[model samples]
Target: MNVSFLRRNRLLAGLFTAVLATGIVAGTAAPASAGNSHHKKIDYVALGDSYAAGQGGGRYLDECLHTKAAYPRAVDKLPGVKLIADATCSGATSLDVLKHQIPRVKHKLQKAELVTLTVGANDIASQEIRETCGAPGAAAPATFDEQRCTTLVLKAIANVKERVLKALVKIDDIRDRVKILVTGYPRLFAAPADAFQARANAAVDGLNAALHQAVKKANMWGVRAYFVDVTRAFHGRLIGDRFPWLHAEGNDTWHPNKWGHLAYSVVVIWHVKRIF
Candidate 1:
């Protein structure tokens, strides 16, 4: 066997062992809300990007677009749930969460019982799909670069994976008293009206896949992170639908509408309840 190959195999084996060990630890560890009662207030924090910030929902709390209609606000209404802080913002990437968003909630995280996050889309430049493949009246790139688009998306996925790992690790550091729930993006369109829409949907799928995998890996490593999929929540309400939940065009193009935010809040609340 090649020495380098042997080293690679050894590394893989070590990682697998570590994952299994963490699984065992997680299985035996005390529940996040072990002694908590219904009467106790649950310190909750929300963090992420436009989706979490409610960019397209309507009235904005600030330039970040954090809105009164955002899911976090809805979550705050739940019994025993207290909104500690919502650090989400429009156009925030994973790195932004690491630097800016996390700091806003870092101290709160140490005492939080629940933390909800919906990041990573901005990390992959989701808007590029609209600018490149889906730009109206603009000629599509040559067939030779079709694969290039795919490669670019793949590279973004890899970068997102690393960033997610780092973010999860940081969250875990302050999550001894918390349960973290990370959300995945919804598919951009239910059915492609044209090649542009098709390509955009595919890109969304890739981004969501990367997020799902990252959450799974984090759980396996005992990071105590869970993925809450919202893809299906917008099943019939994708862009181009008569009553779409997402914006088809405008400054908030591709972002969810108010109805979409309501759906997201419902899904998140359901998951939070299930976890506790």
Candidate 2:
């Protein structure tokens, strides 16, 4: 609650920063419990958008931009955690996960003990950010069209119920034993230097809010699903900062850089340890 106290604890400081920036979490901070609680290896299957695909980390293995530096790969490095499959791809939507990525896993999904999904922002929010702000090109946008951005963001939030939540239900419909850890996107900017940064950050907050609620709704349906909030993982090290973990240019623009993926991996592993 106090600066000196937070300064003494980096973890507390990080959560404090997340609260101020990302606003109220839709559910409890403790992720839903599932999986074998005993420390065990996971037969993991990674699915969803570019963030899940490791898009910005580095050289890609395919058109999907599935880089070796992806957070899932980092997690796979842990002892006994074998990567069953990573069907993540850039620009994938919730439906894309159900239609394409899921099928790629085949019977593996039933065998997999842990599945991680990061979707929905690409469904509508990011496009609105690009519209209200500016297309991510050489650098982060300096200006923002607040009125239009806000309008589009509102629609995107509403769309989340139908598009994002439904996808969760479908995934939940699959074998219930498989634990689904649905991760939320992080704020792309640190201090939010201008309208573009501020509004873009807000847009992600809206997306995450809807997503958090969606996961809660899934849990109420008796599904083994949980929300992994990584909103403050890049708290003070976001875009507009000297050492941003997100890409400022190239095809990976706005996607997490290698260091960013590492941070994501840490948040995920921490959550996994806390839950399991």
Candidate 3:
């Protein structure tokens, strides 16, 4: 062999050997990738009723029982998500979630890393209240019998409170490794400037107050459960702002519109990011 050609061939072999040795050393000394080894895989599950299901958000996934607009889908976008089940149905109350959703999980809850629940709206007939309050001539009642409305709302609140507590207990049993999130209701009515509107607003405030109290009692597990307050975020805008995620008045009034879903996603993401 020509001496110069022989030297060049040896140099090429040396470079190849060095490359193979570097890879072997790396494989033995360190992990395959910093992301692969240290990254924690999370199983995220969403529960509760319509708000969590994204009833009118205009897009949905058939298999997971989810709407694309709901916060779970948004959360799945985060890194290291291994599984997500957005099985919350449109009319589910707190009990429905605890009894129905928990049994349907094919994936084990033992590995759950996060959970988000938006419930209690369906514990009573909120739509009926609105219809009665806004009846053609119900406004300015001669006697102002708030009892009829208050009783209906209170009953609903009480039922939801009990169910929520029960659900939280089940959650604790399945996976204390999970971070639980409980969200308050979004403003369903426009803030009012008069007596009738004020009464309606007070009713809504009462419902949210009940939700807060329920979460407080149930979140004592040290699982980092927290409530997201979205009531004030849409205080004045819910009525006519063409909210992206709020359904139009006649279109399933209680369900969220696309924009409303986006807003929900933002609030959840804001809090969820903190834990990581």
Candidate 4:
């Protein structure tokens, strides 16, 4: 069996089991009051980590790095849309969102028509992985040890799925009628510039795949969850690209820049129309 393929199957199976354990099933169409109607002002609450907080976009609103140029703010500008709260923070994990961010937005979410979540990257420690695996002159065994990397990536993906499910359950408890868009992270490089870059990009692919599966399971469990793929929106604009929308190499490397945030907003706005 292909090792990568097997890992993906395992990750998806874990997500299915997590959702099944919650005892929720994809049901009939949402109620008319599901908040997609145009007559009502949509209460939007943004949740999750740095990407959702708009860390790299600058113009910080607070320590959380919530920016006026962020996708949520762009979405907020839409007709009949009102941003009730932005509980996103730069270093938030899924557990952090569940513990700290959720409480802050629970009241607002109770009446929210739309909620956008961009999490799970921090849970899997993408930044840390890049730092370790892509560091200059890092030593590796003479013989490739694919199993070691596979094991670590699989475990990380599973943890992300578990935490994401838990967070989704909490959101469901608070607001069952809202449309939840769970966005995935984009590949940092359009093409691997080196061996370490290859490994790092592979890890990102695994993370995105896990997030996609989690969102799918959430929808299966009648949670009204949707995965928004920003990969295509980020095409040809990776870290090494000539006109990169993401930070190249620094403390902020891989985070989307202002143009990237605008692209994210476009993808989100397209999905928002479908939901509302």
Q: What is the TM-score of each candidate against the true structure?
A: 0.80, 0.77, 0.73, 0.79
For residue 107, model 3's alpha carbon misses the true position, in angstroms, by: 5.1
- Give lDDT for model 1: 0.74
Model 3 stretches with alpha carbons more than 4 Å out: 1-40, 60-65, 126-145, 193-200, 221-223, 241-245
Clashing pairs in 1: none
lDDT of each: 0.74, 0.71, 0.64, 0.74
Instruction: List all candidate RMSDs to the true structure.
Output: 13.7, 7.8, 15.6, 11.3
Candidate 2, pairs of clashing residues:
none
User: Model 2: runs farther than 4 Å from truth?
Assistant: 1-41, 125-129, 132-148
Best by TM-score: 1
TM-score ranking of the models: 1, 4, 2, 3
Q: Is candidate 2 or candidate 3 better by TM-score?
A: 2
Give per-residue lDDT, candidate 2, residue 82. 65
1 against 2, candidate with superior TM-score: 1
Give a tens-digit lDDT track for model 2, residues 1-276. 657434534664364345323211213322323222233356778888889888888888999888887878765654445678888888887778767877777577777777888987786646545655564442344565567767776876777655666666665566566778889988887787776678778878888888888888888888678899987767766788766778877666788887777678777766655444
Tens-place lDDT per residue, model 4, 174-220, is 98867888898888887787876786677778888887888888777
